[model samples]
Target: MTKQKGKLGLTARIFIGMVLGFALGLALHGFAPDSSFTASCLTLFQIGGKLFVASLKMLVVPLVFVSLVCGTCSLSDPTKLGRLGVKAIGLYLITTALAITLAITLAVLVKPGIGLELHSDASFKASAAPSLADVITNLVPSNPIQAMAQGNMLQIIVFAVLFGVAIALSGKAGERIAKVFEDFNEVIMKLVTILMNLAPYGVFCLMAKLFADKGLDTLGSLGKYFFLVLGVLAIHAFISYPVLLKLLARLSPLMFLRKMRDTALFAFSTASSNATLPVTLETVTKKLGVNNSIASFTVPLGATINMDGTAIMQGVATVFIAQVYGIDLSLTDYLMVILTATLASVGTAGVPGVGLIMLAMVLNQVHLPVEGIGLIMGVDRLLDMTRTAVNVTGDAMVTLVVAKSEGELDEGRFNDPNAAKAEEEVHLPHGHA
Candidate 1:
C-alpha cells in the first residue's frame, strides 16, 4: 500500500505529539503557575491520557490469552515450549542481574546519595512479600475466569498455555478448536490496529498532563538520584541491550531500536509494561519478524517477569538510601543487594508499586531503613516512565534473541526498513463504524 498524501507515519506522528505536548505542558506550568484555566486544561489532559492508557490496557488480557493460545497450539513440538520458557526466563534473569549490578557500580562511583541528610517525613509501609512457595502455587489458577477478571497475568498465561497444549493434543477436535482460536486471534489483532491509530493523540495527552504537573520541579534535592537512574536506564537501553542484540541474535541493534520507536514511546507514555504488551507483541511479530509462536509466549511472560528497569532503580535506590543513612555497605552487602534485587524481580512480579517494594526488600537485606524509600518517592514518577520504556525494550531484545536461537526469526522482515510501515496506518473500510 502506498502512503497517503501528506500523512506522517505513526512513529513520526507520535514523536511530534510528544514534543508538542511537552512544550505545551512546560508553557502552562511556567506562565500560569496557578489559574483555574490551567487546572481545567490539566484536568482535560489527564482525562484524555487516562482514556488512552485504559484503552491500551483493555486489550492486554484478551490479547495475551488469545494470542498465546493460538501460538501455543500451533507448536509442532510440545517440548519446544519448555525450551522456549527456559531461554526466555534465563535471559530475563541474566539481564536483570546485569542491570542491578550496573546500577550499583554506577551508583557507588557517582555517590548520588553522599552527604545528603537522612531526614524525611516520608514514611513507607511495605506490604509483606509472598514466599516462593506461594508464587509457585499461585501460578496455577483454580478458576481461570476469576484470574482473567483480576487481570492476573501469570495465571492467565499458565491457563492459556495449558488450554493450547490440550488443543494441540486433541487430534481432530483440537484442529477445529484451534481454527476457531485462529479466527479470534485475527479479530483481536484488528482491535489492536484500531487502537494503534489512536495512539498519537493518546500519547500527546499523556505527555502533556504528565509534564504540566511534574515539570522539572520534582528534581530538587533528588536530582542526583533521579538522573543517575535515568542514566543507567539509558545505558541499559542503548548500550546494554544493543550489545546483547548483536552478540546473541547477530541482529543490527540500530535496526532493532529504530523499529522499536513506537512501542517504546507507548511504554514510556503509559508506564505499564502490561499496557504496552499489545504494541510490543505487534512490533515483534510484524516489524521485528519473530514468529508468533515465540513472540506470543515470550512477550507476555517478559511483561510480567522482565523488569530490568525496575531492577536498575532498586539497585541505585538501595545504594542511595544506604549512603544517605551513612551506612557503609560491605562488599558482601553489595553482593546481597544484587542477588536480592534480581530474585525479587520474579518474586514480587505483578504487585502494585513493585519497584519500591523490591527496593524495600533490598534495603532490608542490607539492613537499611525502609523509610528511606520516602526520600526518593517524589522523583519516581518521571523515572518510572523512562524505566518502563527500558523494560519493554529489554522484553523485545530477549524475544529477538530467543526467536533467533530457535530459528524463528525472519531476518528479511527484520532488516527491511518499511516492513510494517503501511500496516501500522490502518484505515477502516468506507461506511464502517
Candidate 2:
C-alpha cells in the first residue's frame, strides 16, 4: 500500500479526466469546427471510448453468471432467495412508480413544453411491446448458452437462480462446484479491478467524444424540456432516494452517496448499466459493505429492471409531447400515463432502446403521437448519460436496503471513510514498472 501513498485516488483522477475532456472537447468544437484534424481526433476519441466500454461489457456476462451462482448457493436457506427477490423487485417497482409520478406532477405544474414554436420533420417508428404472456414465457431460457451469448439478462438471471438452487441440493458435489465458482468469482473481480484502473482514460475519451460530437447546442433548442428532465433526475437522485434510504433502511444517505461517487461516474460515462455492472458490483460489495451474496444477485437484477431514471424521462416526455402537439390530456390520461409507464418498465425489460420503447408504449396508451419521440432524440444522449447514473444509484440503494433488512450489512465498514482504500488504488509490485 506504500506504493500508492500520495497518489491521487481513482475517483479524483477520473474526475480530472472528465473535466479536462470536457474542456478539450469544447475547445476542439469551438476552434476547429470544420477542420479535418478535428474530425480525426473525434474518430480516435470515439474508438478509444467504445473500446473501453466494450472491455467493461466483456466482463458482464461472466461476472453476472458466476457471481450470481456463487451468491445463490452460499445462502443457507434457499427460501431467503425468494424473500430477497420479493423485497428487491418490490422496492424497484415502488421507486419507479414514484419516479414517474413525481415527473408527471412536476411536468404538469412546470409546463416545460408550452409555447414551443419548434417544428421538426423527424419521425420515429416504435417497436411493438411484448404481451404479458410473451414476457413471462421468455423468462425461462430454452438454451442458456444462447441466452449468455445474446446477453439476455432476464433469462440469464432465471437460469442462474435455478442452477444455484439445484447445486444447493446436490450434497458434496454441489459444495465442490460452489467452491470452484467462488474462486472464479474472485478471479472475475480481479479482472474488474484491472479494468477500473484504466477507467480514467476511458472516461476521458467518452466525454470528449460526446461533447465534441454533440455540444451544448442540442440543449439550446429544447432548453425548457431538457432542463426539466434534468431537474427531475437530480431531484430523484438527490432527494427522493435519500429520503427513502433514511426512512426505510435508516442509513446515512450522505455516506452512501460519497461511497457511490466512483460508480456513479462510471455509469455516467458509459451510459450503459450492463457495461458498468462490474464496477457497481464492486462498489456495493467492497466499498458499501454489502454482502457479495446480496450484491451479486440484486445488482444484475436492478440493471435489467430498475429504470427509475428512464421512467422519469418517460413521464416528463409524455407530458411534454402532449403539450407540444396542442393536445390536452385529462386527469385520467395522466394517471394512465403513470400506470402504463411504470408497468411498461418491467414489461419491456431487457429490450434495446427500452427507454424510448417504453415511452412509445406510454404515448400509444395515452393517444399521443409516437413520432413525438424524435423531437427529444436530439438531447437524449446527454440525458441518457445522466439518467444512467441515477439508475445505478437506485440499484445500489435498493441493494443496501435489502441487505440491511436481512442483517447482511456491515455498518462499521460503511461508515468508515476509508473502508476500501486499498481496493480503490492500483499499484504494481516493486520493480514491475
- Write the residue-wise lDDT of candidate 2 on 79-130 in tens digits: 8999999999999999999999999999999998899875546799888887
What lDDT does each candidate get? Answer: 0.90, 0.89
Candidate 2 — what's its lDDT?
0.89
Residue range with the least summed lDDT across 10 consecutive positions in model 2: 345-354
* Model 1 stretches astray by more than 4 angstroms: 1-6, 348-352
Candidate 1 per-residue C-alpha lDDT over 159-251 given as tens digits, one digit per residue, 9 for 90 to 100: 999999999999999999999989988998889988988888988998888778878888988988999999999999999999999999899
RMSD of each: 1.9, 1.9
Model 1: lowest-lDDT 10 consecutive positions:
345-354
TM-score of each: 0.96, 0.96
